[model samples]
Target: MRILSAPLLPLLVTFIPPHVTRAQTTSVVLPFRRTFSLSVSASPIILSLPAQNEPYWLSVALCGAILPYPRFFVSNESDVTLPGPGGVQGSQTGEELNLDEGLITYRAQMSSGGALAIWPSSGAGANWTIDVAAIQDDFPTHRRLSQLPLLGDTSATRALIFSPPFFTRETQEPIFPNYTFQDAIPSVPPIPSSAEPNTTLLLFPTANANATVWLTNSACALTSKLGGVMTTTATRTVYRDSSGWRRQWFVDGLSASTNYTAYVIENNAQVSGPSYLRTKSDSFPCPLAHSIPYCPEVSYAVPLPAPPGSATSYTDDNIPQDIKA
Candidate 1:
């Protein structure tokens, strides 16, 4: 009889009876798929405003795009004060004036109409031109929206026509920061995780709404002291992958030989079915260790599904065979 070398003990361990570990756990996770129904409407335009001393308001329409607070300017017009109390540095709404560029901005409560009202100091009129432009996506941080390309038509020859003051008589409305309007509610559900310890999975939601994921030991139920939860309060970037926009999150430090149930919530409403996964027993060794500290001697067998009609149990003969002895 031949005795295996001490160096080869770990290698020989691979050929030992396969039942030394727990039964195999199946990971029947399905990928999450979601598509957005976007309706692109013809872009609307608002022309130039009349440079006048009287309070002048204009109603600019946004064709389905999220309109941010707008900024107004007086081309070649200076030494003119905006409407409101004397010595006010900016506009009536307390917005600062871009004097270098002859621009005045309004950070008031406004709606989709983008109702913009402005009044110059008495006798400040004629030849002077009023240029009104608004930002899209409600992303005020992106100053580029006030510059070229994204700034749309800024040329004097192509200035948009603003509706005459009181022509629409629009009122100040509430402001929606970073608001988005979709044709329909999206149904991006939480995907199931693999049946492995320390598993991380990707989650996707239909809208950029406040989202959360809840994990529980009980299927379809949230039991205190036996569950975990995570939430996304602020807006996050949605990655475009083969399965559309998705976000990844890790579930680590989970106990081996455990069952986990996960679900999704959008804006405080449950939006997905209970996803389930079972972890392998701690006694079972992972096919591949993430890292090895010592000289690696063991060459584990490649894991494969059991043959059709084969018993779930693995024995010395039917276990996955190693590529090398």
Candidate 2:
């Protein structure tokens, strides 16, 4: 998300000749599919005021292209004072500036006065300028409505304009931090202790760019006994991946028949939901053992005797019977 450092003011100036010899009226037609380059010195521009207890809105209008969905974002630089009312009074610093860049499907009516005002809904003031140019040399062929009407000219020309100069203001309020965890899964299936030993576990989540991961044993008896438990292991690194796919390795030291739970910690302290896994049982016989104790030197050819007066159950001729001779 891009944060606003200062307000962008208009720069381009155009004079339109009156069609009816009346006072020349000005209309702005924002071009579609154009790269807008705006440069403002930090000293002159005013940072918006922090939003207080209420939500703030920033509105922007587009003439050629449709408006975008409403989005809210906080600025990185804050507490900036610009020349304004009351000789520059200090306001909320470093608050989020809500922007409503909604898509404008309907074109501006040429007959009606052609002036679109783009401002924040919360009325937080900002100093910024917009520069618009055609996306391509040729404009879109689709015809909808005529462009903004100039005082005397019948046709509208593509150009950039700025809102009337205004003071930057913002409401101040406590903002809560938000986080999300995602792409969490077991790295590998539970493996036997005696088997070829490289098993691992992994998890991922969407967190701030600087977020970190923490692993904890959720179902451990000690943790259950105590209301809160310290994390058994933790790893911290800058959040390089936005997909949140983090990985950790679990080498072969786990005990048999033991269940373990894992979790991801983001942004240093925020904890994610726990995932459960169990170590392979140790009770199962080790396949490497050579001696067989249950049936010593047992032969596969041996057959069992049939029940008395019952159908022959033994298929082999040499049936093992009690030696009573």
TM-score of each: 0.19, 0.18
- Give the winner by TM-score: 1
C-alpha lDDT of all candidate models, in order: 0.25, 0.23
Q: Global lDDT for candidate 1?
A: 0.25
Tens digit per residue, CA lDDT, model 2, 199-266: 12222222211232211321111122222222122221111122221222212233455544433322
Note each model's CA RMSD in angstroms: 32.1, 29.4
Model 1 alpha-carbon drift over 4 Å, by segment:
1-240, 287-325
Clash pairs of candidate 1? 46-160, 46-161, 47-160, 47-161, 47-162, 48-160, 98-103
Which ten residues in a row are the worst by lDDT in model 2?
149-158
User: Cα RMSD (Å) between model 2 and the true structure?
Assistant: 29.4
